[model samples]
Target: MNAVAHNAQSVINAAGSTLEFLSFTLGKEEYGISIQKVQELRGYDTVTRIANAPEFIKGVVNLRGIIVPIIDMRIKFKLGTPSYDQFTVVVILHLENHVVGMVVDSVSDVITLTPEQIKPPPEMNSALATDYLLGLGTVDERMLILIDIEKLMSGADMGLAERSPA
Candidate 1:
């Protein structure tokens, strides 16, 4: 086989066996979510505060015509003081017929990981509960905490649903 054709075949084979993740950072740690769950990426914008909302619930913003509740993973995980800088981004996710946005320090890139690169998360007490993690993915020298975005968003603590007026 020609060198060029061999390389093309290798690329095609790799793409079919790997899963893609949209990697982002929160504090110094790196995290990733399934790329299929991501609806879009948006710059961090001011959100309207909701009464009686939890601190992690940064509030809601109008995304096109729909309202999206923005959650700060840093606050949700009690990592540290969450800040909004130029690098701050909101990852819009479409889950279970609901749209939500998550704020992260910065979005790095989309990474493809084969099943062999993923490891089951270790059982330990940590800021983030294990239930919210899919597993750990290692790429090169970096480790990505694979977030179960759907479970995290729909959990009771997130309060993603709109509260009806009393």
Candidate 2:
């Protein structure tokens, strides 16, 4: 192949091998989710509480006429008592069949991590189970806990819808 063709192929291969993540902060630690699953990001807002719902479930919100259940990650992960302020954000996720919102402290940025930059998460007793973790992604001096968002949101514990909205 010619030099120019080789360079173009290299670029295409590199892009195909890398994955993009939407990074956000929970407390002092950072976490990431696949960017493809993110529907939108919205500032924290009041949600109508559901009767007899779990505390981790902040309740549901009307998003453009669709009611979306909001789950607070800080509470779910047992990081600490969650405090809401201007910086708090709700990341709307579009899963295979359902749409849900996850509240976080704040969103950092969208980071692209090559396959080589990701490492398997350590197997240790922690608030979050290893099954819910995709791996740990390292970018520069930062280490982000890559979350398996689909698995987490779709689990029976989350009580999310199993079918897409009509």
Candidate 3:
């Protein structure tokens, strides 16, 4: 076989049924989302405040001519008073129609895990709804709360339901 064919086979075998997640921190816990949905990462910056927008909606920022809405997950989850220090970051996500940016405490490295490593999210009563969670990912000593970024961003609480603010 040629070198290119050999390399392709190696990658396919190594990646067998594995999924990648972009891990990030919120408050004191770690969370993750599908890496394929992530467009890019940027440092937290000032946003234009919108009238009647939800508190969690920190407003919007222009990303390459696109008005991308920024949501502070800390505020949405009621973690605590969010602090925008140097470590604060904005995770740019590419949904079906809109490109949204999520403000996270800090971003960690990407994690790769197989289907077996991903366990069902435990039943619990909390600010984070189970419908927004994909599952719990376990990688060695770390536990990542995998979330459905697309669904969460499109939820009613995200100020993108169906009615425009009047």
Q: Judging by TM-score against the true structure, name the best candidate.
A: 2
Model 1: weakest 10-residue lDDT segment is: 3-12
Listed in order, each prediction's TM-score against the native is 0.84, 0.86, 0.84
Worst 10 residues of 2 by lDDT: 3-12
lDDT of 3 by residue, 3-96 (tens): 3334323433464799899999998899999898899999999999999888999999999988888999999999999999999999998886
lDDT at position 31, candidate 1: 98
* Clashing residue pairs, backbone N/CA/C < 3 A, model 1: none
Q: Where is model 1 more than 4 Å wrong at Cα?
A: 1-16, 125-128, 161-166
| Candidates 2 and 3, the one with greater lDDT | 2
* Per-residue lDDT value at 84 in model 1: 93
How many clashing pairs does model 2 include? 0
How many steric overlaps are in each model, in order? 0, 0, 0
Ranking by TM-score: 2, 3, 1
